[model samples]
Target: MRTPPNEAVATDTVDEGAGPERTCVLSRVVRPKDALVRLALGPDGQVAPDVRARAPGRGAWIGVDRRTVDEANAKGRLKGALSRAFKTQALEIPSDLGERIETALRQHALDRLGLEARGGMLVNGAERVEAAARQGKVHLLIHAADAGADGRRKLDQAWRVGGGGPAGLEFPEPRTILSMALGRENVVHIALTDAAAARRVLSAIARWRAFIDPDAGLDGGDAAGPDAGEQIRHEGNA
Candidate 1:
């Protein structure tokens, strides 16, 4: 049975705002366009991921996980779906389309962090983040994958005390990657104070993580929630 795409609504932690709906070519399930990953067809009929959904013209959407997408591609299911979505059989689907989609999603998440940082929506450094978290000013918390366990615990406790949430989202990459993304040095932890900024970052991170590791819990918990990083786990469960 095909489930209708859930309606997107503005929330402090789920989505920044409401947007158009799109249908997933593979599952035939309708969903908020922002909740699905877009694939654009180029001039040469080459299909590519439009993670930002900024590409013009016709496009196909998919709400499935990376493994499913890869399996479909290998078995020609994706090709057939794309053919129907694009209304033609002349398009070319890259063998590494799964890799491409993952890469694009990863980059988009990083880019969103950078943009938020540049706009002064987030603060880095353990001390600063801890201070913000303690004051109840943090809307979102993030930690590099390689962040020390002790450090993460301290910050998570502080965040909870300050009313931030359960814990922070773990970036798939290490400190070096986060540092480069935010144009900082050794960015181990970050705190986003603005609600809209937090929503955007959470949305991007949620989508990326969902495709990469669907079953992983937010902050290693059995389940996820907005105040407890629920949006990340819920965003891509399409």
Candidate 2:
């Protein structure tokens, strides 16, 4: 059976010289920065999600899951963890930290996608995406959450024909959101032609999915989640 999209899988092995790893305050598991979300205290003593992991001051790392965050809050574990991590008991934990983190992750992923578009590393439309897949030039495929099944299947088949194209990601964002990000109308599918850009997009998507549904694995291969046929819709060429 395929793994559920919301099930948290074991962290992928981190290679040497990648970066420093941190322990999750909730799970106590050491994971790479991409596998965890960072929470930092602001000057006002309020806790905030640092999705970019570049916030100043001390930060506490936690597993990317709503349950883990909720459990920590309910058991007062997050409070204690923050106190210890920041060396202060005056920190304030927001009641909606989990929701905030979810929003931040989504925005971060979209921002990266926009960057890829601006850099000319992104391609859209079924025909263009399919052509790139057939040529094995697509480093990553991103299908909108509500993309049509027929189009997705055709592209997937072409990708396989090209000796198996790179991993495909089913983004949770709807077509409208994706369209807006790429400055196009009705963007249902996207292809990342540049390897570096694809990696950046994949990392952002992995972090966002991990936070919203920790059980969802980000193996960078087949797309997973809700059925693509449920909200099928065709889009015009780019």
Candidate 3:
């Protein structure tokens, strides 16, 4: 079931100097750039998602939630919104805008992970991650969606023992996706030893999660639900 949109709720606190705030054309709520998805009209008269928020020219910013996009598409609100936002009625709204945005978000997160890996800030493999956790060198722990319960518990315990690392974060992508991202064979667990890299990866993941599931708390608390880990295990087993 699709979660209902919380466009009326102001869940995010404004961060000064983070960037210029943009108003969601659908909900009329002003929020930081991180909390919104930017859409730009191309020269071909087609609208495309600018997930990186780097597209040139005027752009329409929408709240970071799938429901927002779905609703706008369903009610033909996007056409009107784009026309007003860009001051053009010739723009074309793609039927798969939502799906494209989702794919872009997933790719963006994976790309960030790949960059972190290249920077030597990320360590993979269960044993290596556990060792980093034990040494208190891990600033963030990332567990693949399909990671086994035993492996996850082992590293969780190690992180607890180390006592300074943040709680283990479960990536929504499976082990295969994680492996491909880091150019590894079978990545089930990863540790971010550098604080800056961890924050960058976390920010990317948070933006994707917020777009897919707005209810997810991006601050390491109940990303999906109270039983997110259990749900992941169940899905993996299935």
- Number of the top-ranking candidate, with TM-score as the measure: 1
Between 2 and 3, whose lDDT is larger?
3
Report the Cα lDDT for residue 134, model 2: 80
Ranking by lDDT: 1, 3, 2
Per-residue accuracy of model 3 over 1-238 as CA lDDT, tens digit each: 0011211111122332355678888889886666577898899889998878788888998874887887888789888988999998998898889889989888988998998899898899888988987877776678898888788779877975665333477788899999999999999999888765766676677667878876655433423323232211000000
Point out the higher-scoring one by TM-score: 2 or 3: 2
Q: What TM-score, over all chains together, does every model reach? A: 0.87, 0.83, 0.82
Instruction: List runs of model 1 lying over 4 Å from the truth.
Output: 1-18, 220-238
lDDT of 2 by residue, 92-188 (tens): 9988888899998888889888988999998999999889778767766778888877877887777655544333467887899999988888999
What's the lDDT for residue 221 in model 3? 41
Per-residue lDDT over 169-211 for candidate 1, one digit per residue giving the tens place of the 0 to 100 score: 7778899999999999999999988766777777787677777
In angstroms, give how far residue 100 of model 3 lies from its true place: 0.5
> What TM-score should be assigned to candidate 1?
0.87
What lDDT score goes with residue 36 in model 1?
83
